[model samples]
Target chain A: MALDQSFVGRTYPPTDSYEVGREKIREFAEAIGDTNPAYTDAEAAKALGYSDVIAPPTFVFAITFKAAGQVIEDPQLGLDYSRVVHGDQKFAYTRPVRSGDRLSVTSTIEAIKSMAGNDIIDIRGEVHDEAGEHVVTAFTKLVARADREA
Target chain B: MTAKIAYDEVEVGTELPAQTFPVSRATLVRYAGASGDFNPIHWNEKFAKEVGLPDVIAHGMFTMAEAIRVVTDWTGDPGAVAEYGVRFTKPVVVPNDETGALIEVSAKVAAKLDDDDRTVRVDLTAMSAGQKVLGMSRAVVRLA
Candidate 1:
């Protein structure tokens, strides 16, 4: 079934703030085999002018995607969770996310389209710091494959 | 953060050093835990196969992270990246084995997108198992 077009442009309330942690950043970097000092050492990050350890660019995806769950799990949205796959992703940053920053994300449905019997949705997540300053905006595209029975 | 690579020193077509990252099932499990994306297709071979995948696969975000290292390693500052994007073109299949999969990433300066900010656009290619896994992968970096 095609998603309701009315959901387009709908925005969800901001999620509870998630504090960016130094250790989590280190863990994520290590998982990806990235040994960048800036991810693990505050001093190294400071050398780059960041007040503390900064997360890798894609670190905020974990936060934003979780926030998008509000839309994905919306009872009326009618998206089949088991059939969806990440199709595309993009992020534009105002600044690198730093350790100790309390961040929240506001997710909005940017667009919805049905093509070749597949449902495609574009979601935009706006991330902000505790100070309510814009930090970064993430655009995610998810595709729900056509039901096999269809 | 200022990039170690001076913008003035680089031109369109300047190649960033290429890198190859290995992704075992353990790597996917670690990434899943760290990223909070416990999608079973990334770790459970049976579930992945049932879901129509050949085998357990790496998370698309994991591949995206690995692909960006070429740019960050060149800049010497992860913060220098202003924008990044990628399209998941294919699944990175990881069979249960000591050596699972390898993602090869190579990038080049695609264009000088800005003058005052000293920013340039980088085009990246991510390949696995002789197939392109990411399409239209690119980054906009602010360089010193």
Candidate 2:
């Protein structure tokens, strides 16, 4: 089934703020096997001009993706979660995300198309700090494979 | 904290040191836990197989993170990256064996942007099991 084309340009309300934690940043860095000091040590981040330990560039993906759930789970969207696969991802940052920052995301459906019987959707997540300042914009593309028998 | 390569010292076509990352089942599990992406295709072999995958695979975001290390390591600052993007061209399949999978990442300065003299665009290639796993991968970083 094709998704609702009207959903394009629909923006969800900002999600509740998620506090970026130092330990979570450390855990993410360690999980990725990146031992960059600026990711784990406050002093190192300070030396680099950040107020505290900073997150790796992709750390915000978790939060923003979760926010995108609002769109994916929309009853009107008609998306089949089982057939979906991530297609592409991109991020543009105003600055590195540091620990102690409270952030929220507003997700909008950028585009929706059907190609080769596959449903492709583009979602854009705009992240902002507690001060309502733009932090980063994450673009995620998801593809739902068409059923073989269809 | 500061970039090791000054903005003035690098130009187009400057190649970054290549690095390889090893991915095991445990690594995928840990990444799933940390990133809050508990997709069955990334950890549960049975589920992955049932879902038409040959084996458990690394998360695309995990691969993206590993690929950007070349830029971060070169700049000596994790915050140096201003923009990053990648297309998931292939899956890095991690077999449930001891050897696991190895992802090799190599990058180069693709271009110097005109709007920002302090920033340059980097092109990256990531390969796993002799197959390219990411396409059109690139990053924009601020240098010292």
Candidate 3:
């Protein structure tokens, strides 16, 4: 199915706040084979100038992907979730992600297009701290590769 | 807690040695288990082709994780990485074969950020089948 161009510029509301936890950070670090002390020890993070244990750079993916679900599960967008492919992801950070920080993401539909028998949709996620400070802007491109005649 | 490579010992254009990581079906499954993301497209080839994908593909995050490992492993401490990001440019197609699959990755000192803090930023790349699967890759690390 073709994407609804009318939904091109829609902006979704911010998702419920997600609290970062040290155990979660440690789990993520272990899963990625990263034995960084700052990710597991609050004292180590303090030594490095953070209020608490900091998350790995890619930890934001969990937050952004969850927030993006609002846009993906929207029937108004006419997207076939089964046909989607993850094209690209980019993040611009104003600050690092820390374990104790509560974060929320506001997802916006950045672009919608059709190319080479594929439908492309770009969703940009703006991650902010509990105090509403911008932390990172994560961009994700989802491509629907279904063979459809235009 | 810090990188072995000193800021003064390396030039801005020095390339970190490239690495090739073999991605077997088992590895992808292990990644799915670790990440709590069990999307069928990464493990089920039939499901992938039915959804218009060429075949079962490696998770984008998996590739990014590998690329970051190249940097963090060099620094000897994941905490040394203050910042990092990547653009997923292509899908890594993983076929269910004996050789499984493979992705080749490499890094370079893209930029030198000399602050009083003793750190430098490293940029890296991960590729499969000659397609640039990752881009705009940047990492900030504290040096010894």
Candidate 4:
């Protein structure tokens, strides 16, 4: 089934704020084998002018991806979770995510298209800090493969 | 994070140091826990095979994160990256073994944008098992 084209440009409500914790940042950095001191050491981050420990650039993906769940779970979207694969991802940041900051995301359907029998959807997640300041925007492209036999 | 390189010193086509990132099943498990992405395909070999994958695979996000280390290490500041993007063209398959997989990343300055912030666009190539796993990988970094 094809996705509803009307969903394009539809924006979901902002999700509940998620607190960016220092420990979680450390764990994420370690998982990726990044030993950058700014990721784990507050003094290092402060020296760079950040108030506290800042997460690696990719850390926001975890939060923003979770926020995209609302779009994926929408019944009207008719997206087959089993057939979907991530196609592309991009992020633009106003600043690095710092530990102790609270963030939320508002997802909007950016585009919808069908090509070569595959359903391609683009969702943009706008992340904002507790102060209502823009933090980052993550663009996620999902491709649902068409059934070959069909 | 203090930037190690000055913008004026870097020119278009300057290559950052390359890096190799190793991924094992245990690494995938740890990443799954850390990222809160509990997808069975990234952890359970049986489930992954059942889903028609060759074996358990590393998360695309994980691979993306690993590839960006080359840029962050060069900049000396993870936050120096103002924008980053990638296309998951191939999966970085992680086998259930002591040595899972190795992702090799090499990046170079592709372009310098006209801006007062001293931003440069970096083009990255990530490979695993001698095959490209990521395509159109690029990052825009603000240099001091």
Candidate 5:
């Protein structure tokens, strides 16, 4: 089934603030085998002018992708999660994410297209700090492949 | 955070030292736990095959993380990255073996995006099993 073109430009409400944790940042850095001192040592981060340990560039994906679940799970959209594959990802940051900061994301459907029997959905997640300062914007493209048996 | 590299010192086509990262099943498992992405296709071989994948695959986000290290490592500050993006063109198939897979990443200064901001765009190419896994991968970093 084709997605509702009207769903394009639909904006979801802002998500509750998710506090960034130093340990979580360390864990993520370790998982990727990144040993950059700023990711683990608060002093090193401070030396670099950050108030706290700063997360790696891709760390916000965890937060923003989760917020995008609202659009992916919308029944009216009829997206089959099992068939979906991440196609592309982009992020523009106003500043690096620092530990102890509380962030929230508001997701909006940027575009919806159908091509070669596949459904493509583009979601833009705007992240903000507790003070409503724009922190980053994440653009995600999800492709739902055509069902073989259908 | 300020970048270690000076904008005046870098030119278009300047190359960053290439690096390779190994990805085993354990690596994927650890990434899944840390990133909160418990997709079965990243771990369960059978489920991945059932889903039309060759075998267990690495997460696209994980690959993206690995690729950007080239830029961050060069800048000497993780916070210097202003923008980053990638297209998952191919999956990095990880075989269940002692040597699971290797992602080789190399980047170069592609263009000078801004002068006042001292930012340059770096284009990265990531390969695994001799096939490009990411396309249109790039990062815009602010330099001192």
Candidate 6:
């Protein structure tokens, strides 16, 4: 099925509040093979003026994708999950992500198009602190294969 | 974060130290679990081959994360980063071997900004097999 062009410019509800815990941050760092003190040591991050340990950059993916699910799983969008390829991702941060900071994401379907029988969809996720401060904006691109190839 | 280098100490062409990120199958598996991006292409060689890929590939986010580590490590703080962006130019092919694959990352200071916060733009590059995998890479890092 062709992608539903009508889904362009759609916005998803803000995600449920995700409390950024120090341990989750540590697990992410360890999984990525990063042993940075700031990610694991609260004192290290405190020295940097943070109240608690901070998450590594790109740690927001888990949260942001959870938010983006509202858009991708939209039944009306006609996105073929089986044929999609992660094309790219870019992050613009107003501040670094830190543990203990509750965060939420609001996703928007920034763009959609068809090229060479492929459906290209771009999603922009705006992450904000619990206090309603903008923290980061993440852009994701996905390319869906042609139905004929399926 | 005691940054000895200030915006005035930088320019449009100062160079940051180069970095290299090794992509091992184990690391990829760990990342898949951490990031919740359990795509088969990042782990299953058979599915990768079906898509005409060389082998199980590295997650694009993993590559981006390694590159960001350089800037954050240099700044001595993660919050110092104001903005970071990258365009995935190519796939990081991971061969199933004991040693796995490697991607070298290098960057230079591209610009400086200091109206409200002291910051510098760190331009980065990731290459594998002598070919650019991620390009137009850059980050703006804040300073004390």
Whose DockQ is higher: candidate 5's or candidate 6's?
A: 5
Question: What is residue B103's positional error in candidate 2, in angstroms?
Answer: 0.5
Residue range A1-150, candidate 3, lDDT tens digits: 568888878899999999988888887777665667777888877776778888777788888998999999997787877667777776666766888788999999999998876899999999999999998888888888865544
The window of 10 residues in a row where model 4 chain B has the poorest summed lDDT is: B1-10
For A57-87, candidate 6 gives per-residue lDDT tens digits of: 8899889978888877787786878887777
| Candidate 4: chain B TM-score against the reference chain B | 0.97
How would you order the candidates by lDDT, starting with the best?
A: 5, 1, 2, 4, 6, 3
lDDT of 2 by residue, B1-144 (tens): 478788888889999999999999999999999999999899999999998899999999999999999999999987789899999999999998999999999999998885355889999999999999999999999888
Please write out the lDDT profile of model 2 over residues A24-125, one tens digit for every residue. Answer: 999999999999999998888899898999999999999999999999898889888889999999999998899999999999999999998899999999
| Lowest summed lDDT window (length 10), candidate 5 chain A | A141-150
Give the DockQ-based CAPRI class for model 1. Answer: high
Q: Candidate 4 regions off by >4 Å?
A: none
Q: Compared with the true structure, what per-residue lDDT tens digits does model 3 show for residues B16-108?
A: 777787787887887777667799988998888886789999988988877887876666555566666777788889988887767888888
DockQ values for all predictions?
Answer: 0.91, 0.85, 0.40, 0.83, 0.92, 0.65
Q: What stretches of model 2 exceed 4 Å from their correct place?
A: none
lDDT of 5 at A36: 93
Model 5 agreement with the true structure over B1-144: per-residue lDDT tens digits: 778999999999999999999999999999999999999999999999997899999999999999999998899898899999999999999999999999999999999989998999999999999999999999999999
Candidate 4 local lDDT, A41-79, one digit each (tens): 999999998999999888999999999999988888878
In order, candidate lDDTs are 0.95, 0.94, 0.80, 0.93, 0.96, 0.83
Best by lDDT: 5
In order of listing, the candidates' clash counts read 0, 0, 0, 0, 0, 0
Q: Which is better, 1 or 4, measured by DockQ?
A: 1
The pairs that clash in candidate 2 are: none
Interface RMSD for every prediction, one decimal?
Answer: 0.6, 1.1, 3.2, 1.0, 0.5, 1.6
Residues B1-144, candidate 1: write the lDDT tens digits.
Answer: 778999999999999999999999999999999999998999998998998889998999999999999999999999899999999999899989889999999999999988899999999999999999999999999999
